[model samples]
Target: MTREKSQSIASQKLQQKVKGPVAQELKEMVPNRKSHQREPRSKDAASNSPVQASVQSIITQIQNGKPNVSGSKETPEDLSFVMSSIFPKETGSVDTSNLKMKPLDYERPDVPRLSFGLERVLFNPGVYHLRDPRSRVYNFDPYLGAIMPVSEFDFDALKAYITSSKDETLAGIARAEKKKYIGSSSSMTSVLSHFHYLLSNWRGVDTRMMSQNFPDHMRSFTRLLRSPAAMFLRYQNGSYAIDADKEFDSANILMNLGKSMEKLLTLPKEDFERYRRTHENKISAEEEQAIPEAYHYSTMGDFLMRSQLDAYDPRLPGTGMFDLKTRAVVSIRMDARNFEHGLGYEIRHVQGGYESYEREYYDMIRAAFLKYSLQVRIGRMDGIFVAFHNIERIFGFQYVSLPEMDQALHGQTDTSLGDAEFRLSIGLWNKILDKVTAKFPKRSIRLHFETRDAQTPFMYIFAEPVTNDEIEYIQTKNQAEIDAYQRRILNLEPKDGNDDLDETPASPEKPAANSQPTAEQNAQPDAQAAYDSSAPPDESFLAELEAEEADLFKGKEIMAMTLVVKNLVNGSPVDRPMVFRADDKWTVEYELSELQGKQVSRLYNACQTRREKALSGRGEDEADAASNVYIRRLRDLAMKGRAYRAKQDDFDSKHGTVVLDEDV
Candidate 1:
């Protein structure tokens, strides 16, 4: 038989095998199909229908190197093109065992908990839907395409297959006629050349160095190359070198951004600071004190900006903790700030800017987290955990202290954390301090708190002790407060010792709602018995527990603290020994001075919007309910220890909700 005849026969057999949507689509595309009547044929279309002619024409064009049909010359996509992608020649023999038709093992919890904490589910594992490769439903980046498996159960085998496929692609490129590649603006070729150049040099050049020193054509070649041999470039011996054995992939690329993408993604800390120092010329004593150093610096991604890649920072903030079982990075950010304080780490907003509560930010953070998690799960990375760390020292100073806060705080008086008289001032302070320490129990969470003056920089390290004197002072203070507070709480409730502190009783008859136990409490050694007053307390045991609280005060006084009293001009840490009393009121004092007017106006407008909506009978909606709750929380906080909202409303109406110029 002729080769063309055999080819036609094979095509017919393939068509028979290709069932479902593609076949249905092909049948639909056929013209003039009837139960009893035959379709009319054209003169040139000897043995073929219009659909067959069109398909044949497209396939011939494709074979003749005209894959991309121009506008004027374009035709409806051939049926076979769609079938070719979905039921590719190699995958024509479907392996039912390997095909993932159900939820994956990772998707199913081994022993599912009733509720996985927000962070645990923050970036829930991406759902692995069995899909035809041609389907546009999956957001397939080149790197993900190179690593993600079609079947979750055969992940290892699939990854190997993908790697091999990439190798074959590279091999094909290598064997292609070099003469045809002259002046070619091929991203794949550009990436390959750079990779080869880097390997030949043996000494790694960062993305920045690559751009600056090499031809401008190679600016963003690193991101495009989804090669298995990509390395984590770091300092080895004395000079920068790629970890050749290290098979860096997408997640690893993000994880090692500090080392690899530093040239492009970040400016050195000293350089950034020097720029700030020079540009500002001189700063106020308050602004000068918050000069940022020893904190992560934000840099404008030159590649991102130039390439117009205005998206999430590919490199995520570390989780600060890793899974011991798998060494996978496991971290969660508790963004109660958005819901509670209306402040947040906005992902879509420019870096080093105020994070507000918006769906964009929420979606950005979650999507990045989920993508990273998926990468790690597929074994493309060593480990990654994108947990929350209140990195105020890094991003905050730039936003607030760059003459902006000075402008905002200008003419403002008595900027202190102890200003309990300010609306929600005290409550806000407690919430921040509480949330920071409470985020990760036993794990160290570094928190920096500054007054408006920015003079007294307060640093707290969770679960670590600072000075004995400081610890002793706080322990004594808290014990006394706990006694008084408990007595007051107990007095308010009936004689049933089970009355809770965090919640109000549902009814007068039922036992009062108990305060929720903190993460630290849940992790405490003998926590239940030690905290329980129903059982007679052992003196020695109580002493030991008291000692534990001194070092690890859950939500009371900060565990490890450093108070800087120096008149420093830069945002560097100053180690000063100072005492913090639990009784002394601490208020939430951020450099909202720059944003005071704007935020105040915005917030008031938001409140008015909620009020308007409520009046219009739209308050029953979820959004209105949330807005009402946010407004009420802010209102309640602002009015704490004050006479009423009337006194503050006038001031709030003018300055803002957060700006308090009054004396304590």
Candidate 2:
């Protein structure tokens, strides 16, 4: 048999022999490593025991596809459990008296701080408000159709409610995963925002956790060395760039599941924006209202920080805000995406479930707390409520305060505030970032981050060149600035110095009504609108998907299509290309009411031409997005883009194109 086939079979047998949550970590590994090369073994490298040798034997068999294997049916008990499981899970509330203590008050190095009384420095604002500089990126209203008061937090009730809808939620997530939720998918709305965490982790890697925080400052890289090494990346667009390698993201699944749980666990109090929406949108006020947006923004130096609160619990003292988290019982392995029948992918009861039967305290400390702590502190929230589940059932829920999380990660030798160590890490990370940027400003670069089991403290970072895009991936305050840089660097005039779609302005028409329209009517703009990145897709066009795309989509259930259309205009245009369902066809909303009919006809003709061109230009490889499934999201987007182009063309045609500071 081939080496790859042998490796797959051997790995499968080994995982099958393991039970409980021990196999969870085995599912996700660092990419491109011979093993967990990203985290080198500093402590156990010199020691060799039977357990180590036996595990090595298994690895060797898998790697070389040897004739005999440790995990073969003849030697089933060759290895009892992965060594990490020695701690075992004795579930229930964990005792924390042994953990070190420190006061919660500390100033955030990034945000402005306020001091109260003698030493209490509140780094996170009691209330959050800051200018958001991103466009194309969209905001969404929170879902409040089933929020309950914080005082009424009944684990049993939550378990009952969530468990009932578990199947539907998992199924929805499965379908979403299958579709890979591209283009205008709600998952894409705050896409850049999600990268901050991973970025911080990359920056914060040092020896306080291993001294002045250098590679050789003091000692142990043990903790970081023990971390899962599967995360790898390539940077782009002034932020952590997206990669196709991250096709099946468990983190996203957790985020979605967590959001659903938050809606269920939250208090029904209407947020300020939702109250405003009720007053403004007459239809929304008269009908079921769209929930207000739920997120807080703050700036730390030149970087942007956004904290998405899961829920606000007044019942909790102080900040009262708390995050809801879903800890999956186990990660679904690549070989078996059988989410439906998988042993660990289902939901359970709050009382006697998988959690009760397993030990999670050490697991929480070693595996989850740092990230959980970072998130809690980012919002300066009171704490987090965690739901442990095996997907088939609900195990239970537990709350860990910021202080508790701090103690677990930092321990009792209090430095300056409980967050002193973290602050230092941030400073050092920034320094490293500054050096890198200084060396390669305004250029696209590849960062090869990985661990090497071949050496001690296996972390390695390789900086190399990549074919540059128009815009740099360095830090910027907002999307507009990023756009500005692109405009300055890129020539609008085509290679032959001729304008293909020369930008111009059409004759001015009467202004659109100042009154707001329904969410469906004007998805993104009050004047020239486009589809909100977060707007519910116009899936009424799904029938066209089956007809125009592929036979595989024939008779399949209606699902979200994965097509993305970029913003076509760059200057003084507030009415972006928002996609909306207008009668039988999707149209961009024209904020200028008097011009809607003419605008619609022009865009319709433009879109038709673009669609024909896009269809004719398709290639075999780029055609199927989901399995053998094909979609017109690309063609539809091209049509939408052409419609946008027509808008720009009308303008340039009426008023000859001019290049000015703001004329992009």
Candidate 3:
């Protein structure tokens, strides 16, 4: 027997054994879980336990691929009763089973995807205006649409709803397991992992009775994980919401957006000329700042209303990510260049400890957040996504030491307004860290930061700095690898030694109305436009021109029908030559070697005689005839190019050599 076959059989036997005794114990524990909570144990203490051993066996089985995961087996429909039986009142008013569920979909090109970091301004204004319409209690009413003002948004109420929904989802899974949701064809190890994750963290979710129904349990568990309830529990925290004054209202945000849009649409020809005359530079300072904000708001509004969800069903909701707890789509950005923005200037680390200093930009950060929060309040934005570029490379993953945080919190400072504001921001951040540590006591802050790093350039920041051990694999790469990573992340090309950086233009998200290209035109590259590194090169790109030329000559047959047309008219004023034009039909019908030797000599002699006669003081009738023949030959050459393109496209598609567009 093959080694793989032997391993598969062994895994099957082990799984069968787990169903015998341990399964019964797991099933019995669920009914009595309310009496007590399991005491936390160190990894060492639990390493040798039977449950752990069983889990290990299940992992092995998955690795062997004895069980399949794609097919689904029906499980119990009502798991909510399990949780409802324990916490009846906490389950809230929302019907967990009826709260329509959908699969998670993240890919959407039109929806602004930003990373968490400094230059967040690129998308922050739009994020500050995002409000979820599916949410029942937050800004949405399910039927009525956005109904509540930002001030009316209650975090506690939102959390309660998701919590209740989660309990019901877990209950459904438990019931499904009891009824045997795991299909006979399902891969045992793959299905078991879902239960293992829940069992490790949550007690009373024993599915041992349904050990035979591993498939069913896995499907239910996956559904629960994709639900809004799971997303809220995983991402929402102290840093999820911006702290702003009670009187602040984000409603003005919409007004600001409207004004910005109006300014863009209302520009006149005379105003353009006046502005141009007033400033010799292409754009004035005010216009530079105003244009992006206008684009941001306009793009945000359109996405909210029409963006499609990342799912099979197109009608549910747009793919704008929402924090169920806060009801906002967090906009993100990464600014690796500098930490000059925001309230970062107040505290600086020197000599392994943080030192306090006052800088002109201290209030700059505070005022920015205040304004941002005000917009968040009005727009109902939930979280801020940011990435500190070069942070991990410069300071390592664990840059913010606990001592530094403490120092920033209590260090002495001048009595200036900026310094005072900085202190307040620091104190709030400290409290946020405390909440994060308490909420996820077992998780390492460093790991969380690393995982977030992996999601950089498009990561959303909850109101706090939370770290987990799950670092993206890319984070481990060295400087050279990082260069490749940056290129991929930004969809940029590697800089060759001879690259000229000066000619590159900034890539604008949206072109002006007059500058907008049609879909057909945009789909094909223009031979006339200058090269744009941000965009894919035109079809006849210079880089590939040589290769195309080589391919044209690759075949043994180089020429088809060699036709030499000579002008037989007398001399004319124009100086012209007998040209060679290869038609598509000629290339298809004849070989290059077939048209060589005698054929070329005969064609060349006829062409010279005709050319001399056509150029001599000729009759108008003869000259016109010669001119028509030249134009017809030129048309035939153009047809050859078109035919080549058509053939190339067919071959690429048939051979699966086409490049797919990524959702950038």
In terms of TM-score, which candidate is strongest? 2
> Which of the two, 1 or 2, has more TM-score?
2
Give each model's clash number.
18, 37, 44
Judge candidate 1 at residue 30 and give its lDDT: 36
lDDT: worst 10-residue window of model 2: 558-567
**Model-by-model lDDT, in order?**
0.24, 0.30, 0.22
Runs with alpha carbons beyond 4 Å of true place in candidate 3: 1-5, 12-237, 241-281, 290-664
lDDT accuracy of residue 395 in candidate 3: 11
Q: Write the per-residue lDDT of candidate 2 for residues 1-664, one digit (tens) a residue.
A: 8656655665666666555543543432212234534544443441222223334444553454333211101111111222222321111111112122222232322321111110111233221111111221111111221222211222212222211012233234324333211111111112221121222222222223221222222211223222221111223323332121121121112323453344434423332223221234222332222333344333232222335556554456666666666565432211112222223332221222122212233345544565666555545567766655433333344566776554444443221223432332233223333344445554433332222121011122233333322112211112343233223223322344332212221211321222111122221232111111212224444233223323322332211100011111222121121221111111111110011111222122222222222222212112222232222333233344345546745965787543221235
Greater lDDT among 1 and 3 belongs to: 1
**Where is model 2 more than 4 Å wrong at Cα?**
1-256, 267-290, 299-302, 314-318, 330-336, 342-358, 392-395, 413-418, 446-459, 464-664
lDDT of 3 by residue, 1-664 (tens): 8765554454344334434444443333322223445545465543333333323333333333332221111001101111111110100111112221122222323422321121222222212111121221122111111122212222111111112112333234324333111111011112122221211111112123222322323212221111110011122221121111111111112222222222212243333232332334434555544432101110110011011111111221232231111111000001111111111111122111111111111211211222222222222233222211111111100111112221222121221211222222222223323344454553322111000000000001121122321211112212343344334323356556643322222233443322212122222233122111223224456335335334422331211121011111122111111121111010000000112221222122222222222222112112232245533333343345346546744964686331112222
Model 1 lDDT per residue over 246-354, tens place:
1100011112212111111133333323222233442344542443211110111100000001112223233121111111111112112122232222221221112
Q: Is candidate 1 or candidate 3 better by TM-score?
A: 3
